[model samples]
Target: MTQLTDPSGQPPYLRIVAGIRRRIMDGELSPGDRVPSTRQIAKEWGVALATATKALTTLRLEGLVEARPRTGTVVAETAPARPPRRPSPPASPSEQELTLERIVRTAIDIADAEGLSALSMRGVAARLGVAAMSPYRYVPSKDDLVLLMADAAFGDETYPADAPQGWRSRIELGARTLWAVYRRHPWLAQLGSLTRPLLVPNLMVHGEWMLSALDGHGLDPTTLFDIHVLIYSHIQGLAVHLEWEAHAEAATGQSEDQWMDSRADVLRELVDSGRFPTFAKVVGAFDDGYDLRLDALFESGLKALLDGLAPIVES
Candidate 1:
């Protein structure tokens, strides 16, 4: 089996690990010294976040580095000089066999596992066990690749021919379908905004589904489009936080609950301070500390939004 190499004649992640390992072995990065973060590594080495993450994971496996919660990754106190181990190259077909579909699917998987920030042409090629530029042959650039990914992701679901009856039911199905896609690929919400929407065929399938639901209602075009946009905003607005929370956890090494617990003392003080009685009462009402379930929130918000718009849409 042939080992894939980047331009440097070594796998990108290994090269990164070697660089950091050399720094540790040379005492440049002493024990407990802060090591460059994943973002920093990516920026400094011109690699993707996934590549940087892999380098850090290698170092941790070698016991050369350790994570220090809010402090970021640091050189372990007892660093042993061990040569970096080469990862077993993945079994992949030659670049000649690579297809556009394969490239887009691989890119989507990368963005899904890691955040969108972690995706890059080189990273996808690396995962596919091809040369760094192999993916670029199929996808002109990362931006184009992302658009392909979005289209493919949105295309995952389709409305059945026997669609649910009633405008509200049809609209509900469309909204839930979109929310499900965002739930699967949280990075998707970060792709486009309301003003600048992602104009892709598969996404248009969703838009068409939604717009058609509101059609034949004797409603003016402006009011009809307004309602459509409003519904989309609710799903996209909340979905944006999904990626954000994942990013926060990755950067801070704390889950939402853990991070909130870390600030419990401050929250307790804020609640006890007699300044805001109403706010305190709301905080006091929860039998158990609030667990922010985004799914529940999405359902509740969707129902309320549809309920409020029922009169206008029905009329």
Candidate 2:
């Protein structure tokens, strides 16, 4: 039976899992069917978003639900009934050979897979099969752990020691490389602002690349660094949305497209009200709704930014 409440005194998330699991097993929710979103689950069950998220995470770990990029979480087509991801406790802690490298890598994996906010030292220890406080031996705290994680993430890609001829090409290479890192580690953008930037050595390699490219372009030191900061800001600004979108999906249990679609009625009312003639005209011409491809947007904006900078380089 679908559990309306946790009469068995199980945790709220477990109760959610039981109710959803029952629904799935009884063939009520077929393959690829839209499941109740996190918001809907929270509302119906009177639980917080995190609890609802945990329930969904449990389902995903069990291979029951899978998150689709453009679609929200849905029933897996041929999901195997399996246990959730909490592994067996270690028989001997020494067998795992835990080290600072392992600790940072595990932290990175968690940040990369889930997100920065989802990360906790205890969680890293759990994944590493060690005592909850074991990670404290190597990385003292979550803040320091994140710094190391960001350093490792930034170090993943490197530029050639040999120079590309033009400043534009070099700048493009640097921007794209940094973009790839951010794309790989979306959580990286969430840390530090332009004013209070991430000062780790690995991250400075990218700044060095940008600064080197702008060096001989007749611009003074301030102007050169200004241009560098502008380029960096462009990438960071757009990249922040990557994490935001991911969190939004987890919280609302709606994909970007789904969320936009849900808001269509409101948008149509605003558009048809004739207050936005230019907006309506531009939007009305699309036969198919716009696809918000962040990669394409990144590339397009990069080109425009370079085009504007080309004049400065030439002068």
Candidate 3:
């Protein structure tokens, strides 16, 4: 039980903080264990994203949780002195220092470390060590902030002025580069869809690279753009699972391998039941078990895609 009986009109975020803190105190959520992501908190408690973000932010400030690289937020290894459950106001800072670039950079860091749903304007400001509304000064809303963040993230990589020798090679390079970004920042793939794309300058740099490559290769404008979209879809289609799996792991408190192991009996039953013979045969062949390497999978798919595109480009 999380001590939530208080009748005072305390904000929702403080109650959230207390519940999680109770979890920590009770040993249910141990040191080195992953904490539920902001998305999970929001969904479970029926609070807004900002409220969930604030709760985590308050916990972090109080030393109950610490943001770990590669791993999302986790319980701090050693507890520090208990501070107030509610967050204190951030110390005032000069307003002249804030800039659009700094805001976007901080937002990208948050979205990369945490998932996109974890992102909030207040969260970004907290990360920047400024007033909660500071980010709003430069980026009007969360939506506009996301647009700038996408542009900055995509701008991280660009093609060389002298392009690759062949159109296929250029396309491969472009796809790999984009995949690298998504691999680093999985949240980027979940941005706008293929039909309603984000039309920003930096992202357009990539579009221009691919579009230009497919341009003089005998395909009409529509077909050229369509090929570009197809290649992008290949990356985005698979990239969604990257963040989703991460989110699921954090929320469920189980790694993929751990979760699968828990279902081993079910799997064995399925294998022995004789319904999925081909599945059993293939899985049974791997004594050491199969390793699902997304990197290898991406490379394999990219190669197959380029092979299919070869005839069209070469023609």
Q: Is candidate 1 or candidate 2 better by lDDT?
A: 2
Model 3, 31-142: lDDT tens per residue? Answer: 8898887767878887755667667867886889987644668999876545355446434466448778888887897787567887899988876778888788888899
At residue 200, candidate 2 shows an lDDT of: 99
lDDT of each: 0.85, 0.86, 0.80
Q: After superposition, how far is residue 274 of candidate 2 from its true place, in Å?
A: 1.4
TM-score of each: 0.73, 0.79, 0.71
Deviating ranges (above 4 Å) for candidate 3: 1-92
lDDT of 2 by residue, 126-172 (tens): 77778999889998899999999999999999999897998999999
lDDT by residue for model 1 (1-315), tens: 223357756767877888899999988999999888776777788776656776786788789998764466889988886655666676566524888998899889878766898889988888888888878777789999999999999999889888788999999999999999999989999989998999999999999999999999989999999999999999999999999986876676455766788898999999999998998999899876777888999999999999999999888
- After superposition on all CA atoms, how large is the RMSD of candidate 1? 9.1
Sort by TM-score, best first: 2, 1, 3
- Flag the better candidate by TM-score, 2 or 3: 2
Error at 143, model 2, angstroms: 1.0
Better of 1 and 3 by TM-score: 1
Worst 10-residue lDDT window for candidate 3 reads 83-92
